[model samples]
Target: MTAVQPKPTPVGETFDSLNPATDEVVGTYAVHTADEVRAAVERARGAALWWEGLGYAGRAERLQRWKGVLTRRLPQLCQAVRDETGKPLRDAQLESVLAIEHISWAAKHARKVLGRQRRSTGLLMANQAATVEYRPLGVVGVIGPWNYPVYTPLGSITYALAAGNAVVFKPSEYTPGVGKWLVDAFAEIVPEQPVLQLITGFGETGGALVGAGVDKIAFTGSTATGKKIMAAAANTLTPVVIEAGGKDPLLVDVDADLDAAADATVWGAFSNSGQTCIGVERAYVHERVYDDFVAKVVEKTKDVRAGSDAAAQYGPVTMPSQLGVIRRHIADAVERGGKALVGGVDSVDDRYAQPTVLVDVPEDAEAVREETFGPTVTIAKVRDMDEAIEKANATKYGLGSTVFSKTRGVELASRLRAGMTSINAPLSFAGIASLPFGGVGESGFGRIHGPEGLREFSRPKAVARQRFTAPITLTSFHRRASADPMVARLVTFLHGKR
Candidate 1:
């Protein structure tokens, strides 16, 4: 288990984490100031050296033990996740367990993927032995989101830890308790080091950490904020990984299982109040089965309710301002010739947003172009898979997409430009511990989870050792006329006949 750096010396008036469901105060935490951010980074710098010295096997053992701790305390973590984000207990549990899987996988696989390994030198340099290894990049600063707080940040944090880097995580203000809980648990196993640290506050605190000379920053937030983060990190030339918002699309083909597609759409769009980065915001169905698919989706959407009660499948918006965005998206869609098959603009309540499914929305409306980050999905009919692909790739964000087609699921999924595409499954790419998770364009760059996740937190270091001197030397002011011909001969021997 990674060490938890003790909370930085206290700062301004502390803030209370509010339960999004009812606005009740759940826990009180310090509003970490800029000075605290720098202090934490300094502590992490020390811890990282120790962690890196542990090497691959030592870190892997500690990580597996940490996974054991998480598995044993799964319920406690899930409750914290639910209280902070207003997502259902089942969904929270699922995310917590999935995070455990990633922790286990990253620890078990990091040595193979990131440890020093020999590489063959090209023909020109065959006399030298070459090797490549990934080295920890000191302290890593992770700015996590309120939505899927446990799973999303852990995706970056676990990988970073497995790669032997100490972490300073600044979870979204809305879900700080969950962050504190995780840090505290890890502290039990690693008391000697400050390997995993938490600094709680709002946007300014996050910005402070980004510029605090950390080797890298892993941020999951809005694209607008991502741009701001990029600009901030640029000041110090700090590398960053941004998992920005997405308007992911779910495509259904003529031969798709309408029942399954409908079920996935309802859950994917409405889960976590549709606050997920990889959630299905748009559904493009082939014309052959459009009516059936829409009907099934409406039926499923009716059964899911958003509320503060235990029975509710969906929950309130974690951030209050997000309610206004949800309301506007529904209103704009309705105003622009879109028909509400179930919910409408008035569905946005003070706390909970009723499931809203808008059909016939214009392609250019905010609901389609911008991220609706709520439990609302727009359904459209396309002539064929080609048209579906076109509409799916139309958005600027390419984070994740879903395809449901018996014969063409794999083929069509390959065409989408997103980082991950799930065939017949919603967000399945995130669950597969080996696949990379992230996106391109406005959805942001850098990957988390899988081999890519471990590599993201590290810098490649290449080492070349001379085994035997070449017959024709060429480095010094010595004779190299013969060496040039020898190099040409090697290149021709390797590639001329190919």
Candidate 2:
């Protein structure tokens, strides 16, 4: 088995990022050392002060300029993403558009979401005036994933920049080219400060970033790695927002749209070659229409393919080591008496994995219990929605889920134990800028996107001012004898039971 540990590093060493489809070296980057990471963070720490000094309007102007640069060079960015990750050009472009949208949203909404506002000083503190706002937390370090080399990291980087924090980003070693491209693009627009810096390397470099004294770290990766990040960040007491793993589910109700459910399930399960943290890994269909749903899903999945060719719906698996995990999951499911309605164990090749759909997989099997992280999904029949919800909630992860119900969409979606759930659709929540995205439990905590995202890289600063002296003199040392009884009477008058 391929080792899951970080690639070995020597001082001042460099590595090559290869294209998964052809094993061709796409880009070469230095494997930055701990000292280099620390230097980057220190630079960002200084830049953070300057960035925050610009206030919201100035930063928004710069961010808009950066966004414009990214928009104009969209083709190059998309091509870089395609080279690093073996996703289709269209998929890269789609994520590019979404990343740009987030950049625009964060730039436009940061001032409104984090700006100071007058807060009511309740009757108890009538003489005091209160105001609250979010302030930047200095440098923010982001460790991004390779699957979404653009959108996922931008979700954190853009929001952090808009919130007035300078960022130090360490993109996945597998996608360093895309990372370099992003940093280079930002440089052309905001060349004044190292407000956004890039460090390229494997896991050791990422661990260094965690303890580089950055105020906060936004990490998107696996749960096991998230735990390690939390541990490293704990050394400096650096806060973290971890966007980790997800074995999200999709529920198909008896009254739902079968064709729509089939289409959504297929797309959500296999898109990005199932490299999405919020991708649907499990499907629970109501017993009333189980057979029909399975047939439709199998039919739809047959048309979806994974290859390096232009005609394929998806491309090769970016991480070659993941092929073993996909194979194991498929083998385990079939051995456990599960039926493969589509591709089977042998479908996983050296680089690409064709879509695989398994039915009647045991709940405790690895395919259902662990994160497959491949173009594979499991479908099961549930006697009722209650059974479906119970089975869905059985996993340790709760990231993103989907529900298709003609009448109970809201009801079923509300009951799902996930961070974001789409009703009658799949993965639609990721496109809506106003929605907060993240997860609970093994999927991880904290949020990115919308107002919550802006606040994620910030610390709330609350201010209270004395409008005038109070007659009651509750805070004064010089109090008359009757003052105690007067205060007691006031408290009784306001809070005591009638």
Candidate 3:
């Protein structure tokens, strides 16, 4: 008998997550296969029934317990986030704190936002009683982004759970450890079943989850990947909420406080290594104060550094592949007559990218037009706020924006073509629990926060019942010849003046 060789292990059956700052292996995770993903969806389907059966109060009670667990073990969760994404411990803590707040908001307000409410029956159906309630969709697959892993994913996960739906989360391959930690923490509170389950792997695993017969898919990642996710979800006609890429901008008016605007610009552009989807990637300043604002920004960024130390302002780029894109954008800007007032292309290395401020760059430059997703910003001088608004709204991506103006703050903010705008502040919309967070254009559609977020993971269920016999029965075939003329007259009388 000939000896048979054992079958070779699949290429991506297992993988290790590495810390971007040190390249140290944080943990090893199994690369869940398509079959495994389908199995998870199946389990979630059953869990959804049980989870939904709990109703709003029961679900809120369990979610509150999970919130307590997250609050108590926040430090541990933040450490796990730091290890996987190379963010500072403080940044990790901030992300977790925001996520916990979202949980509390979703739990406390779910019943109010999604519970059944009486609806006014129209004149034609005055004798009927109508009610509407938001019902949870079963088995939501959340494909999360690595940047701000805890805050971003939980923005969808917490709200979905609060709305009484089971979730199957597939975090980025680089941040699987963080995903596992969150799932494990939730399991501690709701041990009866896997209400929130984690599946680890690369793009293939995420693709599998998209096609795993999920009722809905909430994806956060690049615009390119979001398109692919939509294509896959279309196979099953599953609805999706996509929080994709963004090329957000910050505007500085002449009447703005130069010092405060500069500080906001620096923090908005460099914090979290500028991996934020809503990070200020472009700055359009009024010509009257453009030079002064640029100088302030340059000076502010001088002390900022990226490293794996307590004193460093930020950490390394979470994904090594993004370094090349950062380099290309910087180099392209410089070659096209853009001046690097602070760091340049040379500041980017294999791991970390220092803060880079580019000025005199044309509107057509890659740094200005594309989503660089780096610690870099292009400062452009515009004649007025009109020009600034025009330039800020020029991009195909409009996720978030910032406006700094003493007098025209609200006016300018309302004119910007984006989903969320911060007035005299940086990223204020994201922290507010009641405001919806998403974007228009290439930033993708749908929301993940506030009352809209709770509704996004659910479907509207309308109930109509006959309270009494109507004088004219229009819905039925019986005795409807004269009812039609009466209904038309009623509608014309009620709406003709408008």
Cα RMSD for predicted model 1: 4.6
Candidate order (TM-score)? 2, 3, 1
RMSD of 3: 4.9
**Whole-model lDDT per candidate:** 0.90, 0.92, 0.91
lDDT for residue 128 in candidate 2, whole number 0-100: 97
Model 1 error, position 247 (Å) = 0.5
Candidate 2 minimal-lDDT segment of 10 residues: 1-10
User: What clash count goes with each model?
Assistant: 0, 0, 0
Better of 1 and 3 by TM-score: 3
Of candidate 3, the 10-residue stretch with the lowest lDDT total is: 1-10
- Per-residue lDDT of 1-498 in model 1, one digit per residue for the tens? 112112222345587787776666788888888999999999999999999999888889888888899899888998999888878898899998899999999999998999889998976777999999999999999999889888999999999999999999999888899999888888877777999999998888999999888999999999999999999999889999999989999999999999999999998999989998899999999999999999999998889898768888877788777888999999999999999999898888766789999999999999999998999999999999899899889989999899999999889988998998999978888899988999999999999999999999999999999999877676878766777787788778888995
**Residue 263, candidate 3: alpha-carbon lDDT:** 96
Give TM per candidate. Answer: 0.96, 0.97, 0.97
Cα lDDT over the full model 2: 0.92
Please provide, for model 2 over 121-147, each residue's C-alpha lDDT reduced to its tens digit, 9 standing for 90 to 100: 978789999999999999999999999
Pairs of residues clashing in candidate 1: none
